[model samples]
Target: MSEQSVTYMDLRFHTPAEQKRKRRPKHTRDTEFSEQEVTYSHLKFHIPSEQQKQQTSTSAESTDYPTPTSSWLVTVILGLLCMALLVTAGVLGAKFLQLSHRVRRQNEELIEKQAILGNFTQLQETLKNCTNQRDDLQAQKANFSKVVSRKGEKCSLCSEGWIEHGGKCYHFSEERRTWKKSQEYCSSHNSRLLVIKNKEELDFINRLVCFHWIGLSRGGAATAMKWEDGTAHSTDLFQVKKETPGESCVALNAEGGAIRKCAEEFRYICEKKPS
Candidate 1:
């Protein structure tokens, strides 16, 4: 073989160690990475900010906790309102009860007053009826005067103690004691001693002359005869023809009905009550 060719063959069939050395993994060169790949790595590094910031962000767990529970607050407000309403209603009801009681009492009092007034009215009516009855009785008693048909002057009987028999009333007195006293009493009674002229008038006067004292004088010691009345001796009515001054005072007999002395204490016939 030629020498040059033998050397070439030996270089080509080098050892395994040399071949391994030749086949070693090459180091990554700076120029091996592309610009786009570096940029992607940078972006991945920045994306870590999201995780770190999320951890650092002051654990703001805004759990929306209501300051007061809505349900509990509603219950409290409702309870307070109910209590207020109940108190107000109770006060008003008490006032109404008091007013009703007062009204009832006043009504009862008014009814009592009305009843009393009605009783008073009834009493007044009864009193008026009684007065009317009294007037009726008085009128009946006066009926007697109307029945007697004697025509005379209508003087009040209580004041005028006598009636006009001959246009005058002659009042002789039983209350007068003596004869002179009887004369004075007759004068004060607006009458003279009773003088009767005619027989008829004399008999009428004598019928009423229960007892009287007169001025007739007695006969001489036997006490005879004179004018029986204290008047000027008149021949017209009382003087007897044969009579003379015998007695100075006279009184009437209870039985024989004649004139006697004024010293006698016999009952005298009065013409008037007083005057």
Candidate 2:
């Protein structure tokens, strides 16, 4: 009891200076400890931990790389650009083809026009030549008319190779021709086919040539036979001996006058007035 009493008395009866000293030490310790804790918390807040550093670095990597959505979007954009380019190319190609076709067609048209122009030029040249020939023939016809107008002026009645009989000139042809062609030949020479006016003329022509075309034909079965000069044939003169069927022209020979087809080929006699 005495010792506990004495320690308790010492504790309770400590000096005010000593107590102040002790309390000051405790306050200083608390202040220092609190400041250190605040500094540690500040460092923890300012500086990153290992796990936080790893998470931050991973976030940065994710931000730097492209996502699948972004990659797909980029591919789709590229595809769209390619499609647009293709469409543009197709349009331009179509336009180019159309332009080429038009140019080719125009070229063909130009060639056709040139060919037609060439044909037209040739036709014009042919027309000019025909006109010149017609003018020359007209000039020759005028000169012939002047010569034939002077009749009974002591000129020769007939040219060479022509026979004069009964104030008419007669020509015998060696070449064979159809009845129509023979008449055309005689007309071209300013004459007509042989026309027998009487029995004497018929006999004369029969002695000259055989199977020769004369200018005697019937217009129809109801019409009588007539000469090329439109003179009617007198039935009383002589009867025409029929040699074949379908006869339309008259021929004379040593055997007498005969009826023959106009299309048959035969020598001819031409009769004309003395010029």
Candidate 3:
């Protein structure tokens, strides 16, 4: 038992609110001075500066989105520009193709013209050669005529009654005889039935104006008409009448030649080269 002194005991008992307050962090100088940048849509925020954020945030966030009308107008302008480019490209391509086709056609035409010019040049050269040859032949003929005109030379190559032509002698008979007998008569006279060599010879015979037997005959064949000298007969010089089966011999007339019977009687012509 002793005397007990009265003592006050301070006991700490925490409530839920006091416990939560103890868990919160305290703000220090580091937290207050440190700066952080924050982006909120188009607005910028800073940790340290509230007044500056308030001044600039309204302007930054208020930037306008384009209105529908202006958006459509810009889209239409871009589309029109694209369409113009496409149309211009198409026109250029078409023009280029057309020009290419025209150039090709012109080149073909020029080639054809060149070919025609070449043919014309060849023809001109050929005609010049022919003219020169004809001139030379004419000169030779003139010289030969001069030689043939000499006094006794004209009749020197021909018989008494025969005529001279083209280095040969021709005789027109007055007596009518069958074609075979006439040929025999000519053979006995060391001559043969008349053979025409060219237009000049045929013309000479035509001047005689009498139907005379020549060497052209069918020779017992229907289609194979030939001369007695065993040379091919030329149909271009004379229009020969159609031969009957029995008419194998040919006679010369002023117009052309005619087929006659071998046994028919007519005056005859004879031809012989100069001895």
Candidate 4:
């Protein structure tokens, strides 16, 4: 009601101040009394005891909700950091070991290569020495050839059993005999008529031969030259006439009197111990 209407009635004016103070305005008591309640102070906005209790209960429930940092967060984080560092350190240490091993292997390989190179050099030196010795040997061979050819150009003829000795003449009339009988005779005596070898032998024999028969001859044009012993001809121990590899008769050389023959009569030249 308007204060003017309440004074016109005069009853509210006579009411005690204490009693009036105790009474709240109608808008404060019943929510339906006003379309909207305006609150400007704590007393006006104060919530009911029941509603406050309900709010307290709801806040208590949310407080019990778990959060990430509530338990063991520091310890767990510290442990994880330590693990990361340990894993990183372990990886680094393994890599370092691998690298170190590789380096050592490389060093060993280099050392081995150097050793091989040293051995190769030593082998080269040895080979060089061998080559030098070989060259010297070849030179000596050439010199020996020259000396032999000059001494063997001439020979004497008409002697008994002449043997060609070292580029010279030596006669052994004891060894002389006819071609066929000479082979058998020499076999009995354990000594054979000398077989002429090269020009040296021919020259030497000529000096001693007096119609000595040789161990070589062809019995006919188609017959092969051979020794009287019935064995095949051999160039290893005896030599035939210069070009008479195919000659067929035995005779003495005109110059050296060296015994020679054709297939018809092959004087034998036997070989044995030096005695």
Which pairs clash inside model 2?
Answer: none
RMSD of each: 31.2, 20.5, 20.0, 22.7
lDDT of each: 0.50, 0.73, 0.75, 0.52
Tell me the tens digit of each residue's lDDT in model 1 across 1-275: 11112211121222334564446445634533321222111211123346665654434432444334776898899999999999999999999999999999999999999999999999897567545644653463254235222433443332233433433343434364766666566667555555544556454454344446644545455644455453343444343432324454544422223445555554343343222
Superposed Cα deviation of residue 92, candidate 2 (Å): 96
* Candidate 2 lDDT for residue 64: 98
The true-versus-predicted C-alpha distance at residue 113 of model 4, in Å, is 1.4
Q: What is the per-residue lDDT of model 4 for residues 1-275, given as tens digits with 9 covering 90 to 100?
A: 11111212222223335555457566566643433334432222333466767777677876986455655787798899999999999999999999999999999999999999999999897567545644653564354335434434543221233333463333333344556676566567565545555666555444434345665556655676655456666565444444444444555533322334432342234433332
Q: Model 4 scores what on Cα lDDT? A: 0.52
TM-score of 3: 0.44
Per the 3 Å backbone cut-off, how many clashing residue pairs does candidate 4 have?
27
Q: Model 3, 244: alpha-carbon shift in Å?
A: 1.3
Q: Each prediction's TM-score against the native?
A: 0.32, 0.41, 0.44, 0.31
Runs of candidate 4 with Cα error greater than 4 angstroms are: 1-71, 148-275
Residue 17 lDDT (model 4): 50
